[model samples]
Target: MRVLGVDPGLTRCGVGVVEGVAGRPLTMVGVGVVRTPADAELGHRLVEIERGIERWLDEYRPERLAVERVFSQHNVRTVMGTAQASAVAMLCAARRGIPVALHTPSEVKAAVTGSGRADKAQVGAMVTRLLRLDAPPKPADAADALALAICHIWRAPAQNRLQQAVAAHRTLKGRTA
Candidate 1:
């Protein structure tokens, strides 16, 4: 499956497209950021994000979209912009009938780095290594976006499979007892 992962921000929203399935290597299709002046009106910033998503939809037409869940930060204004930007991304995905998944920053970090407390630099380093990229994805936000997509792919059904395996192991041990 192909997925477009987005990290929404008013100043610089990161986007990444990755294609793969469970047990298969996910390859980077594209990674970039959408930008609007910090001073730009909220509506204009949302339009910018919408336009960016539309462009990606036209070019890649990913089957699924993954966006970072809106988080309330200390700055209410920042949080508001993020929510607006995220809404635009979700709307774009919905318009195309593409399924959307929203993951929290901690969840993405845990999936990528095996720790929910991982900082941006750590996640970025792991993402670069996981994708086997020569260099870190440009701009920290872009790397975070790619990591978010990879995390979703790794944790989705794969988590269930792992749980099943553990259950089976326990059952076998119980039978032998």
Candidate 2:
């Protein structure tokens, strides 16, 4: 499966693409950050984010989009920007009919580093090793985006099975009723 992972932020939204299935080697198709001027108007920044995400979707044509879910933070302003950027990413993927998955920060960290409380350095180190890169992706955010993709790739199989099981159970229950 090909996945485009998005680490959304107001100024620097990270983007990375990874391709592979579970229990096998994965390839990093691409990695980069979408930058919008901090001074830009809120609407303008969102537009810039939309354009950047759209370009990535057009180029990568990923089967799934994995985005970092926005969580409540003490800094309301920062959280607001992140939520806005995240919405833009989801919008772009929805426009292309690409499936979107939202993973929490702790969930991503645990998947990549075996610890939900892992620090940035630990996550980056694990991402570097997982993708077989000589060096960690820069700016932390970039590495985070890659980590999100890796997490999704590894977890998707089990998630699919669980969904299928639930569907089957619902069908069986309906028949009995």
Lowest summed lDDT window (length 10), candidate 2: 154-163
TM-scores of all candidate predictions against the true structure: 0.87, 0.95
State the lDDT of candidate 1 residue by residue for 1-177, as single tens digits.
788889988888899988888678779999999898887777887888899889988888888888999878799988888898889999999988998888999999998899999998999899898888998998998998899889878776875587799999999999999
Residue 56 lDDT, candidate 2, scale 0-100: 93
Estimate, for each residue in 1-177, the C-alpha lDDT of model 2 and write its tens digit: 999999999999999999999999999999999999998899999999999999999899999999999998899999999999999999999988999998999999999999999999999999999999999999899999999999999999888999899999999999999
Candidate 1 lands at a TM-score of 0.87
Which residue pairs show backbone clashes in model 1? none
Q: For every candidate structure, what is the RMSD over all alpha carbons to the true structure, in angstroms? A: 6.3, 1.3
Compared with the true structure, the alpha-carbon lDDT of candidate 2 equals: 0.95
| lDDT on C-alpha atoms for all candidate structures | 0.88, 0.95
